[model samples]
Target: MSTLSLRGIVRQFGPLRVIHGIDLDIAQGEFVVFVGPSGCGKSTLLRIIAGLDQPNGGQITIDGRDVTGTRAAERGLAMVFQSYALYPHMTVRQNLAFGLENQRMAKEEVARRVAEAARMLQIEHLLARKPGQLSGGQRQRVAIGRTVTREPGIFLFDEPLSNLDAELRVQMRVELTALHKRLQATMIYVTHDQTEAMTMADRIVVLRAGRIEQQGSPLELYNRPANKFVAGFIGSPRMNFLDGQAVGGRSVAFEGLPNLDIPAARETTEGEAVTLGVRPEHLAFTDGAGLPGTVDIVEQMGGESYIYVTLANEARLTVRRPGQTQLHAGEPVRVAIDGAAHLFGRGDDEHAITPRRLP
Candidate 1:
């Protein structure tokens, strides 16, 4: 079993504390992603797990064995870095065999592992190529193959695709997902890209400042965010938020927006300040009704379009529409928000008031 666990993990650099007490349990063979904005300690936490960095206070365990004080190599974890970290002078074959060779692995066993990893990553044809001769994607595959040759208990990837272009990033994301399935290895990946976290992870741990804000399956985080920050951060184009106050016990009133009835599951007292969140896809154009606005900008993608609308109160919102849109900048439009709105209490500790629901 390759299960991993962390307890009371904490890290500090002089007077600055970057990672606060964090506890997590990762099941064997699960592909987990740590996601957050830069400086949020996601990478720090992953480093701690890999034993590259020590936590000021905490315990790390793998398969129920304590490894907090073990050296990085002793912990039996393999890490793929963001920079690929390949030797400039070595060919792909040499790079993959380098680590195993250091351990004095049997020649036959090393050859077998190298051949299997090369085939698995589809890099057999490029084995003789040097890093300078390979493209970004090929070098990345070689980096990953280096880790595979070791067959470590846990695989740690620190933003492995950050160097690739948009199209290659998407392609690598799919390939990584397939690799996880084929190897069935316990994997932990760290990245600031939500799209990567959403598309590749079996579960995502969202971090902020020095603590974990939330952790769950991608759909769970998207459909039922735990707070205002999470609601704003998880989606593409992001969820739109508006200032409002509860009124008549079951309704909310916003400037320039019609009073909206709250769902019974989301109980709110009258006169309480609240923030209302609606995703762009949830806002639909309606004629002769709903909130009044003028299109500020219209962004057209191949399959969908996003209309940026400015309301009377000067509040801007993005409305997503299917396929091509006939809307244009400065055009008058009215948008009706779907009932699947999210409500959160006021201030920094804006806890969610919206009932958790599946999409």
Candidate 2:
């Protein structure tokens, strides 16, 4: 089994501490993604796990064995980096066999792995060609094939699709997902794109600065974010936030909207400052009791439209509706928070004081 565990992991570069007492456990054969913005130490943490970088403290273990002092080559892991680090002069077959040769593995076995990896990645036709002769996607497949031949216990991917174009990235994502299931290997991926993390990961570890803010399934984080950072980061188009005061028992008082009796899973003390969160799809134009705003922009995205509004308090809020929209800029409208609403303590790192956590 390829289970991984990191306990009280800490890292520093001279006097500057980057990772701070991190603790995480990854199950065998699970696809775990580490996601955060740049400088968030995702790549640094991945390197530490891969044994490319040593942590200042804590222990790293694989399958119950303490591997904190193990060499990267002996740790039984292979990493695919952001750049397709293929040797320019080597053919696909040679590149795939190079690592095996360095390990003094049998030539026949090397040939078998190279052939199998090429076949699995559908790059058999490009096996004889050098890296210069392959397309970007083909090159990436070759890069991954190089790792597949290693047959490592865990597959570590550090933004493996970042170099590809948008369409190619989507294609690679599908390929990688299929490959993971085919091998049933434990995979740890690092990316800044939350959409990528959402679509590919069995578990997502949301990191900010250097610490993990929250870790859960894609829907768990989307529906019940632990804090404001996660609430804004996990969803597409992002969740909108408004400043408000908790009042009238389980209700909120905010500018633009009247005191709303929004149900929060957790009860907050009355008069406590809180923030109201609403996703674009949960909001709509209403004729009844609602917040007044003027339409600022209506973007028709084929079968769906995203309507941007300027509230009376000048806070911008987006409402997403299905199909075409008749709304236009400068049109006065009243928007209703129709769907589930979330409440968070004021500021970025507070937990969901409102909305239901997974049952």
lDDT of 1 at 90: 94
| Predicted candidate 1 versus true structure: per-residue lDDT over 117-182, tens digit per residue | 999999999999899999999999999999999999999999999999999999999999998998
Off by over 4 Å in 2: 357-359
User: Once model 2 is optimally superposed onto the true structure by TM-score, how far is the C-alpha of residue 13 displaced, in angstroms?
Assistant: 0.8
| Candidate 2 lDDT trough over 10 residues, lowest sum | 350-359
Q: Which ten residues in a row have the lowest lDDT in candidate 1?
A: 350-359
Candidate 2 structure, TM-score to reference: 0.96
> Which residue pairs clash in candidate 1?
none
Q: Write model 2 residue lDDT over 294-348, tens digit each, in one string.
A: 9999899989999999988898999999999999999999988878788888755
